[model samples]
Target chain A: MSETVLYDYWRSSASYRVRIALNLIGESYRSVPVDLLARAHRAPEHLGRNPQGLVPVLDIDGERFTQSLAIIEYLAETRPESGLLPGVAVGRQRVRALSHAIAMDIHPVCNLGVVAHVTAVAENGEAARRAWMQKFIGEGLAAFERMLDHPATGAFCHGEAPTMADICLVPQVYNARRWEVDLSACPRIVAIEARCAAIDAFARAHPDRSK
Target chain B: MSETVLYDYWRSSASYRVRIALNLIGESYRSVPVDLLARAHRAPEHLGRNPQGLVPVLDIDGERFTQSLAIIEYLAETRPESGLLPGVAVGRQRVRALSHAIAMDIHPVCNLGVVAHVTAVAENGEAARRAWMQKFIGEGLAAFERMLDHPATGAFCHGEAPTMADICLVPQVYNARRWEVDLSACPRIVAIEARCAAIDAFARAHPDRSK
Candidate 1:
């Protein structure tokens, strides 16, 4: 692939997920920051690339891609040797389910846009937003921990290796922490997050280290 | 598949998506309702089947599957002739992106749980919630329309054949209408919805027609 460019935001959980995927796959790519605070993401050119106006849009191999999970799936499908997803159909389905338990159920609800909307309407915006995050994110993780109770969950969400599940896991943990949601009830998730954090790919992809 | 069972709720957009998938593939599955309004999804037995406490859990070949998209993908992969996804790599990614633009971006924000939470926190709760649905659902469809602007789109989200994009699209339009979100700006989406509504599989899977 020639000239792979990822339009990223330093701290967007969605972008962070993609960064970890790229790092784990051992692919070198350039990052251009789209500052959400400065409204860079709302610019017409960026919207032209991704009409959703969401971050972590990847342009690679002469094509533009949106949606972090979809981008990671594309990478995994094209680079099976990277082991982003398991080979078996059932295994892939399990990983995708675990991934969606976070991506679909948690992340989208507490997204910045949603938070902004909540803030615009909520009377006690700060407390309400924090409570909202804590309730949904914490509950979602509790359910996720239950999902990890399955025999297939090992060091990572799927097996011993980090599959697409872990790619989603780390960023969500970051968001939970960012929002100050309690994770004491989710020992399995905490343990898996620790395992992912120990890896250089996930460690370096941390939003704190990003430009 | 000895006996296929779908634990479904009649009005759930997610469950509705799976019903369409099952119908399109000519898969006969018994439907068992899990009433979200009664909080049956939170019961222990249902929780055992899906820790996420979400609907549209499919039981096939003695295995349980959750997450509508994952289940659809699983069915498509294990039953490729069903053609739920496109044949090529880029095509599959595009379909997934389109699907997520609804499944993730639009649906979760407008979900009953999230909206209930929004109402509990927000002032002028009803109006705020309505605006929330209208704004996000409207913008999401507009972006989805832009996605359809590609050469690949035909009668459905991708080519003349109904793929996962169409599967997700039909229900989301159902939701937008249910919420009274205007579709005047989304001609492509409206056009696609009209086409999908005319088809037997999609028509059969409509929430209004569900048992």
Candidate 2:
């Protein structure tokens, strides 16, 4: 069989999300690190794998894929028993919404490239990066906490098992802690993060472990 | 059947994406304007519809949904013939990757709130906003144009039909023109936008017409 390979940056929230997904599926894949800090993602080699020059590009089933959430969806579609997403349409929608609440709303705003641009453009440089991270990560998680108040949210973001929502959540929580964003207002999120942290799949996918 | 309603700000790129989806699905929905400029989205009532307090909160099939891409996924799943996504897994992944290239990568960074914050922090206010818009939108669409270079890209973003990718592409092109981003570098994207603009469903969903 052709091997599954994941090209990822250890600290990228998007890459972290897909790492958890591959672990959950128990898919043994080779991990090729693309260091974002060194601007390695923009190199011709990595850009060839992804025109966007983003990480967590999985070369699987003999085809290369980009976009972490889309990669998760592809994995879920092919490996339904992995439960990366739920079965029913509404459940899947809820999962997708919860995932996007982080992937689209929070993670993108805190992206390394975006933060670098913000820091460069603003007067304070380092201070601007810190403040940018805190404001967006703090506010985005607060809204996510409210979204979790729904009855569908259980030990994980969706139900008893860790679905795509939890996969997206763990990495964002990692970012929050990295930025020292307050988690006091997010009891549900904190609890959910704690639950996901205990899982082998999620635990193995941690940035610290990956590094 | 219960009436379907879409709570959206006419000028929101995210809202515009959903408007195109609903129009494409041939699903008639009551358009409830939640004006972002007036801060209607953050109001208590709108928050009740979506705790995220974002526009393009879709109420359909008796379930209220948030996150524009997720709502489009729901529509595509329920109405497979709509072809918001492709039928095959690989094709679906391609469509989603294209959709998210804009939705997750570009749109969020240039989001009204994000840009407002950027304008506030940078030395120059309006100039910062304009520069921020032009840089991110221009670069993003350029990368998107590169993505469209694949063999899968036909008349539209993915194939002969307009999928979710096209729904995402049109609003972004509107923003590109609104920001006066140089599209001379993106002939393929420009051509695709022209095709989407001609379709009645896409035409009616334009922020101008919605207003």
Candidate 3:
């Protein structure tokens, strides 16, 4: 057995965050793919491991940790040298604010649950669903664009280094693009996503790239 | 003028999260209330502070930090003695994950935007709003109940000490109760909210009690 095993679904943004963090930290781990589309996350064994029935549970050294940002921070704190967070307290907060901007503000509203809700009640089927997605994904990406335009934003969401913010941002941008939201409006976000995609750590963690 | 000023609305759950953290850390600051109902968050000044136009922007030592969880974690880190996060790496991750369970998973879907969306589209009006609120709130609180019922839960969401998780939870529970969501199913969450409310920090920072 590997020292770490990640209970993850290939398309899950939460799981993608952990996968990128692990690669950045250079930690070797086994991937246990939990098929979310098939309701694998709600299975009895997975529920026992995580009562929340969420994917991206990181089994680290026999203990399980859930939540992508938390898992990433744990790796950063334990490894220290991987430098996912800046050394200074203020800088760390900035990084975290950017990360939460996507995780808390953007992703939650556009998740499978919200989409399903829109589809259930919306009048025109595909058009209404697409409108709902566009409104949220567009507004969220616009806000994220403003965040990236801040002087603190460099080659990455934070400074030149890749942090938890970048991990969350890339998956979100990918998802937004998948929904056919225009990226031309948010050049900063587009640039950052491109920068992140070029890296092996982020590239290797792409949903299609993962098993 | 205080070095830090918090842009908050008294009744906003997001702002309430930050207020509890500031009170817990015993930080002296100024409060700049942004009226959510009046659409003050959309104003240029507020939007400048947080492009997302959300409340609970912490203008700390001249730097502005947006997002409730981000601001709370910032305060916890800067004021280590507040004991908002655990000392060990794994413990910290668990605390953060529990906290994010509410912040990212629960709050966003039930907040103003989604509510407005439901109100705009749902033919059932008030009933639809309530249903939307209850569905997201139920899922979130049920997941939170499982986390709280874990062996790690003590008087608060985490250990005996109130951490970031409690800071996020109490406000959400308060909002849920405001909407008249049934709490009978979430004994653990209700119990933890009671434990947290008894403390002066949480009590004083309540929406009705704030300036």
Candidate 4:
């Protein structure tokens, strides 16, 4: 079989999600860092890998895949036993919904490019950027916490397994801490984060470890 | 079967995407408009449906579902003949990558609440809002157009069929036209939008028609 390659940035929430998924499935792969800080993602070579010029593009089974969640979905589908997602439609629906709440509702708003532009146009750039991150990350995580108040949510985001929802939540929580977003009201999220932190797959994929 | 109720805002891109999917599946659904302008989504009634307080919370098959894409996935999975997502992993990957390019990267960055906050913090609020929409939407679609330059793309986003990618594209194009984002360079996207516009499902789901 051909080798798997992951184009990623160590700290990107999207990239981190993929890293954890790969680890969960015990898929050993090469990590090619596309440094966002250096604008490496926008370069032509990187753009060739993904027109969207995003991180965490995976090349496996002789095909390249973009979008962290999509790539994760691809992996989950190919290796259902890995259980990145649930087997049944109802379980899948819940997992995907919880995942999107973070990946879509939270991560994108606090995306580096979007926040950079907002701060650039504001009077106090750095402070505006910090405020932007804290507000969105804090609010997004809090909503995610409320989302966890379901019978379906057990030790992880769904059932007792660490599905895609848990993979997504860990990175957002990481970002929340990075930006000092208050987690006082997000007890469920904090507990899930703590559980995920104990898992080897998640710990190996942490930004600190990867860096 | 239980009646399907869609808690939606007529103008929300996310809501509009679900509307298109329901129309495509020929599913009859009751539209309960959650007025974002009046902050109806933030009310307790809506929150009870979806803690995220987002529109397009679907009550279908006696279960409540949040997140437009996840609901669409459930619809697709339960009705595989509908072909909202492709059957194969590779096809699903491409379709999902295309979908996320718009749904995750573009739509969320231009979310109403995020824009409202960004604009409020800027000096010239209205102008900043316009520029923000144009910049993100314009760049996002341009990249999407580039993504379309692949063998998988056909009359629709993936193959000749309208999958989740097209479901996502239609609403984003609606927003682009609403915000008057320049579309000259996005010929593939423009052409796809035109094709999707010709379909009955897409036409009926149009915000103008729905409103």
Candidate 3 wrong stretches, greater than 4 Å: none
Candidate 3: clashing pairs of residues: none
- TM-score for chain A, candidates 1 onward in order: 0.98, 0.98, 0.96, 0.98
Ten-residue segment with the worst summed lDDT in candidate 2 chain A? A108-117
Candidate 1 residues A42-136, lDDT tens each? 99988888888889899987888999999999999999999999999999999999999999999999999888888778888888778888988
Off by over 4 Å in 1: none
After the best TM-score superposition of candidate 4, give how far the Cα of residue A54 lies from its true spot, in angstroms. 1.1
Candidates 1 and 3 compared: the better one by TM-score is 1
Between 1 and 3, whose DockQ is larger? 1
For model 3, what is the C-alpha lDDT against the true structure?
0.86
Local accuracy of candidate 2 as per-residue lDDT tens digits, A75-165: 9999999999999999999999999999999999998888888998899989999999999999999999999999998888898999999
User: Model 4: how large is the Cα RMSD against the reference?
Assistant: 0.8
* Candidate 4 lDDT by residue in tens digits, A1-211: 8889999999999999999999999999999999999999999999989888889899999999999999999999999899899989999999999999999998999999999899888988899999999989988888888888899889989989899999999999898888998899988889988999999999999999877
| TM-score of each candidate structure, all chains considered together | 0.98, 0.99, 0.97, 0.99
Candidates 2 and 3 compared: the better one by TM-score is 2
The first chain of model 1 has a TM-score of 0.98
Per-residue lDDT for A186 in model 1? 92
- Which ranges of candidate 4 are over 4 A from the true structure? none
